[model samples]
Target: MALSKFLGLFLIHIALLSSSCFAADPFVFYDFEVSYITASPLGVPQQVIAINNKFPGPTINSTTNNNVVINVRNKLDESLLLHWSGIQQRRSSWQDGLPGTNCPIPPKWNWTYQFQVKDQIGSFFYFPSLHFQRAAGGFGGFIINNRDIIPIPFGSPDGDITILIGDWYTRNHTALRKALDAGKDLGMPDGVLINGKGPYQYNDTLVPDGIDYETIDVHPGKTYRLRVHNVGISTSLNFRIQSHNLLLAETEGSYTVQQNYTSLDIHVGQSYSFLLTTDQNASSDYYIVASARFVNESQWKRVTGVAILRYSNSKGKAAGPLPDPPQDEYDKTFSMNQARSIRWNVSASGARPNPQGSFRYGSINVTEIFVLKNKPPVTIDGKRRTTLSGISFVNPATPIRLADQFKVKGVYKLDFPSRPLTGPPKMETSVINGTFRGFMEVILQNNDTKVQTYHLSGYAFFVVGMDYGEWSENSRGTYNKWDGIARSTTQVYPGAWTAILISLDNVGVWNLRTENLDSWYLGQETYIRVVNPEVTNKTELPMPDNVLYCGALSKRQKYAKKSRFYVNGYLRKMAVKTNNG
Candidate 1:
């Protein structure tokens, strides 16, 4: 009887332990209704796509390892898909929100993205991934805090701040899309915006009675963590606060080596976190400036945005005059130096250096290399398209993941070339097949005179090297093999190249594309299919039941009525050949 009582006591202890663990990791939920909203960001009334009728959507805040459930309902006429920028969906690639991997949530349909933040804690974001809607603003901040047990590498700030820097256009989304489709560039933005509001300027002159600028209130002598994201469709922005040195803390999911800087160059689709200690004189306010860089550097006079950093104890709203901006936006020497200085904090207690995690990238054995080059503008199928390795990518009739999951054929081919294309551009669907868990080295060569930024979905790559000239086998010696920073997006200088090493640990069809929205729409993108040798519960789970299949896959049932033949669970209709019928 005494032994039986001891066993009961042991079971009770186990149950209490399990209950405490469950309480530590809680679920966070959000319902996002994407619809049209009328708001004036630049003092001009314009209709924009927003979530829950808010201009900048809603900010998502949660802790690491929490299951985040976001129910997105598309109420607009067009379809919608939200890309969780820098959130390495891990093995759950279906929630990556790439059009090639997951089908778009059609208009009037609601889809819930269920996934875990999982070992990641840093500054990230979410934005609409379809129909150029990101420019229209269905974007928001996605902040993940460290769990209770995990100690942050840096000191806790007194307060937290989030700023989104981007270029704003006066024209509507429809007008912008039509212009791009007509083989014309976006030219230039009306002005830059900080958190969706700034002085409306044209031709270097502010509009009469422009809207009030966005203000960030802070207490004196307190340090604040400022998380910034460059969510612009195009253009690189250099962000700075007058007379304050920024202590770099983090970038995306990796904790960076803390360094002090006056200005930070944030490329498109990139996010950064910096610590701003307000130890400056509290007598006057300061100016937070975000100026356009790399694009139209000659027209710097009209490419700047400003905001106010107000101290709580300041007397008046006088934010003084703007300080001198970065001397030269096109200074490649200065930009390259800043980029090289960003290194990974190897001693940080995170997945980056943990031997048990998937991000032990320092010891990875690279198995394959892909050399991609950006070619000159070329015409494909009577439309101007940006060439990537001679193949201007085109979206297939059906989503590639669905096609692959059902074993359907003809959606895409696996003959994408790894070497740079030699002569002319061609109309082709570039689909590169990859082996699961294989380490990959991607070299991006930019022969054009324009600077380019590239973003990869589902994984963050280590920025190993950025060379001035072309990339070759000899350039491998210049790689920063030890302390290179891991990021989801990187910039390639004009007439130069950038190399990154990534491990294909996530199984899904992922997209590697230019951050320039116009270039992406013009086919400067490709897909990598990471196929698992065996579909198992551990490697890749089965497709969720709620996945919405669209495009050609939806029409296959109608075609099956005419000609009945099953092709990999999908009905295939044969075409009847005739002489003159």
Candidate 2:
């Protein structure tokens, strides 16, 4: 018999055997109705696709590699598909759910997916594929691995805790889609939610039913594993327990060198597993704390969620709030110098609203800016543009012309503003010279001729070097600088920080050194790209850590428009990975 036919028969036989093991009573069929729900108290309807009307669908259990079957009935008007993230299946890429990989199941149509199980032993999550409709609010679930790579220290625990941190735009998921579709703007969610609930409650005096929240329960004397996943649109989170500590053991599905018992930081598209051993003798009552660490106005500062760690009478009593929450390890005051610095900024741009001027066709204009000094500008039109007085361009002509004239040399458009770089508008563009405050703000437009500009705060730059610029020779046959740093081979005096972006795609490697930076600024990041390219061979470029922005420069310029200085560059795929290599 063929392998396919044999597997189908085997699964049927196993299903029959499993059914026979149970009692004579009817099977307990768990039914879940998927739709959008809101947890935000703002009275706005946040669509949340859920099962059995629950934001997070019920859990599915079975032994690993078992023939697990699930009937997913779509009720929405759009087609839906599921994605088992990180799950590897041989010759089963058809079920990958990546759009364009195969035509997605049509609305109301049932597309049964069957594949052998092959995954690491741990907690995993499922989402309706990368399709916009499903992602907005659709199918989601947790996968538990009973097959253990290493036995649990305490054997199978009595219970498990899974904390999923996700964002909901109460108004309408369409609001977000519209923003992305129109090339408009989107801010961080207004309220932070944990387990589909928010914080802050109001009594009758303030406003009855103003806010209702839920907290997780924990017991003392018992060890618990916390599986934390951040599913916000795009934001890294720093979390801690209000009065207790945890032993962090794993990150991004990988084990740590040692159990790190401290409040930790986790970024989006990342996960962490922690082992908690409560104080057995004290009275039970502890709170779990998770907060967002965005540093810009447009970004949100949210208290994601809280859970109570309670113990049973058998274990003993728990203490009241363990001496005021210990200083968070990532506290800005203490961690300022210890943490490595990275260049970051929030940015946006535009293109003609006409149909032909679509972002996908590389016809939209884009601009990005950063808060720190010396960091190169966000790249657009194939290169980076730096600003001093308002949004000035650094070698803007090169990238813009290249993008317009050459199709193969297109630059990746990016936005990396963790928050809006906003302030009072004081400067205006001069029609005669196409300049702002004596500086050129190079504007790049789409085929439709729509233009965009960006600015950052408190940072100034001086031209350092350029690959196309004239530079001196080192006397020997070889060039002196690695890529682009000094203005010339003979003049290597820590080339002054310039408001210019060095296109990493072709430069091979480059450096952007900085000096004075705003005190309020923290690191910046975003998952933004204008182009979608297939993965290919390796390419070397300057890593974030080495792109230091502190240096000594003689000249300084002020913005007359009451605008902040900005750095521009396309958020290359390299910037998103912690370890680019």
Candidate 3:
């Protein structure tokens, strides 16, 4: 009987080994220590948040389906959370760093964020999600490479570079938070930064107070891929190199229909990649300009920031004056046209041997439609507040997910309207209840004078149609049902609307908010709660370990069911065979 059982177990272990999930995916690890360092990213020295003592934190690079584990140690005086911008936290919204989705990481405590970068590629970022900490630095780039079996859409470039551009304000995060709390506008930033450095104008001109200018050194006749991210708190900036045409390759995570432009407008929470060849004059450097758009120039202190592109054969200073933008500073039409130009490359493979999972989004049946509008800033309780429709979002006491899971009462209200309201402003939760596998068509209409950008947490929505004026049913006729680009973040023009199609396949409570941190803190955000029919751990992972209790969970004696991070039965046979071989 023992000999027979041993032979049977050996055969079973061999079969299980072939079928196990651990065969394909590899693990990546990171230890991030969040603390404050005194340094000058702009001209003046002040306290800025740093990760591993670096101004901009280290980069996290992985291929598709790779498991990334990051241990975040918070050393700030207050609670903080780090959000992965544009990452599809598939089946794992709990790892998403939105304030209400997951409890904040308290000071001196650490937590691990373990999630697979499933079915994603291209450029993205991570930043502090709460308390306006993004204003004081602490952001980094995240790049998901394609698997070795998957083919890249374009030819291989000689090198790759990441350029993080943003508008910089001298005020610390605490002051920014306090000002927003007092209902005041942040006005404008003092200058712009490229790769955490000040404007080129500040590199000198002051004795013992000069700042370093970011310069990209390269050899002539080589092609490079430049991944650009607008990591600003609030601002739409135009990026361009003085003497080169930017060949737009990809944006967000999807491959784009390659197009060439003199400049492109990148809004807050948006990212794009371009391919450029060092084909300019080798003996001189060229200016790289990033300037603010759609802001009052006279009132804004600084409008443009500069960087230099130096060639290996350059001899002296940059050749000529800074290049002019493709359009006037306030031309709305130009910005709209640029946004429309980005389309998905339907033939290019991403993540697998298929074109974005071969998702024919247009052919799917639409199960729901929602019209959400952004109202102009209004005074609420004597404080300037931003609202969606007639409601200003107020965070619930406990996370909506936990409240729903543990049967906690009154922790959140779920009657959020699906359309714009014509009533008085109400301060309450921003919970939009959704069904599992619900196919949705959402119209984000911005009636406010200023341009606005919106972002969803879990899935990349296809931008099908957009236009000026109210979005009528007839607007659906103008939709690009064929090759609309898919992205997690999108922009809505002033007095215009952007139409998107999203499939609610991922289940959990996700955050939908504006990328502008000021407006986000002041109540212009929402929680999208997607409920599956079955509440078992199969639909979504169970409560992760080491979750610090907050709100009602703190008063409870027992924690919720914990995650079973292992496979049973068959795995034991595999282990026994390996141990006795």
Candidate 4:
């Protein structure tokens, strides 16, 4: 009887081994199924394409610069494509997975992608690019260059952790795309998700429909990496390792000067990674907390899911309850001001051929009526004729160019003032003509006494500064604070390109330079006087340079009906203490 029972147990073990998940080996061709998963909370299967029901699909580990072949099969009805947004391709540009760059794989079709895994030795991501599928429920996963060594803040068990931040909408992706394709204005996201799960489904039991509500487990005396990416178009999130401070390791896959914080602010189209170490020899249970950056006006805002990090008893004690996230963590003042400013413009113009390729129009093509009767076909002006309302053109790639005769020193400041954060200004028609006639005022002041060449990072621009009008935050009285920053006279140029640059020590030296272009023109110089700032007398690092900026103004005065050009660029990079700032 004992022999028989032992044999039966051995047989069961064999069966379980056959069904257990095995780590995928390198260079092995793999196939995955993308489908809906019937979750317990809603009793409805979520439409997720999964490798073995894993929403993140699978973690891929490979050596430096290893080439991998992935055979992706679209099990769903929609056409699917894959994009590596972060990975810089070596030579094969066609593998970029852009819609028109190459063809998208049709539904039920299989496509083989060949690319070399970069050896940069950092954490990366891989996801799906289906017809509106990524926004919905199609793909997720991370890629690692296991260089026989791992990142810092390590321990034995539960030593490292990676959190993938993303958002999800319950509405069908196809349906949503249809609305977007139809030109309907789709608003914000309904929910923020972390790793394809939400708190209500992961840890909240009060919600009767919760699914797989397992708290995240973490051990004390261990370190982990929280890899974050905001894949959703709508919701922005601030995530924190509950009760534990985090050290930022990298931003956008590039290492930054290490800084510690209890939480991180993640914006749309941004990714960040954090390294966190827990107290060794402490009680284990830990939570990864997530919250929306802002609560919508509507009641019952969505809460992102939670995870538990369980540690061994010998590891340590449970940390105190998670602290409240900092209220101003998501403030634009903090995130926007801290970064070096890189600026460019968005244009609504026609495409023109250049040395390399066609300068693009708008991202998409949309039409509108314009009343520019005197405008020349090739220039912003036709025999100095004025415009009423002009054509409304839309495309993502509209090429904005620098003016034929002017050089922008650089972008200084973009002030929206406390009031009128949204909406067009009065005298709209006058502003349009004023700006078109080079009457828009753009002020640049050099606070630094030492000379430094400042380069505006993105999009080319024409230099124009002319007096147009006075701009004040309050209508009750005029303030001198807005004087130099708010110029009455300015230069009017098209709005396709946004950012400009300036020399640090030179009071009013406007430099003419174009990046990504090799030609220089003799007529491209503008003479504008620089006004000194009255607010402060000292010139030091990080002091307000006192340069105010206004764009897309038809006239230097204010927003008007005729100021029709699109202003799309945001400032991104600013270099200090460099010869070519």
lDDT of each: 0.79, 0.35, 0.80, 0.37
Measured by TM-score, the strongest candidate is 3
Candidate 3 similarity to native, TM-score: 0.90
Clashing pairs in 1: none
What clash count goes with each model?
0, 36, 0, 86
Per-residue lDDT tens digits for candidate 3, residues 129-208, read 87899999899999888888888888888988989889888899999889888767887787888888876752333212
TM-score of each: 0.89, 0.50, 0.90, 0.51
lDDT of 1 by residue, 397-479 (tens): 67888898778888888978899777668877769888787889999998877778998887778999997888999998999
Runs in model 4 with CA error above 4 Å? 1-30, 40-44, 146-158, 182-188, 200-209, 280-284, 294-300, 314-322, 329-331, 337-581
lDDT for model 4 comes to 0.37
Looking at model 4, residue 58 earns an lDDT score of: 63
lDDT accuracy of residue 138 in candidate 2: 50
RMSD in angstroms, all models? 10.1, 19.6, 6.2, 21.3
**TM-score of candidate 2 relative to the true fold:** 0.50
User: Which candidate number has the best lDDT?
Assistant: 3
For model 1, the stretches where C-alpha displacement exceeds 4 angstroms are 1-25, 200-204, 295-298, 328-331, 353-363, 555-581
The sequence of per-residue lDDT tens digits that candidate 2 reaches over residues 1-581 is 69996677556534542432222322212223445554443334556676556766665443345433344455665656665543332223334443312234445543334433332234445566433443354534344354444343233454567776655455455555555444333455555455655543322322225454545665556767777765444434556664456665443223333344456554343355677766544444455555554334223434344434555543433334322222543543332111111111111111111112121212222233332212233333432333222222121212221222234232322222222235421111101111111221111111111111111111111112222112233211221122111110010111211122211121110111111111001111111111113222122111111011111110111221111111101111112221234
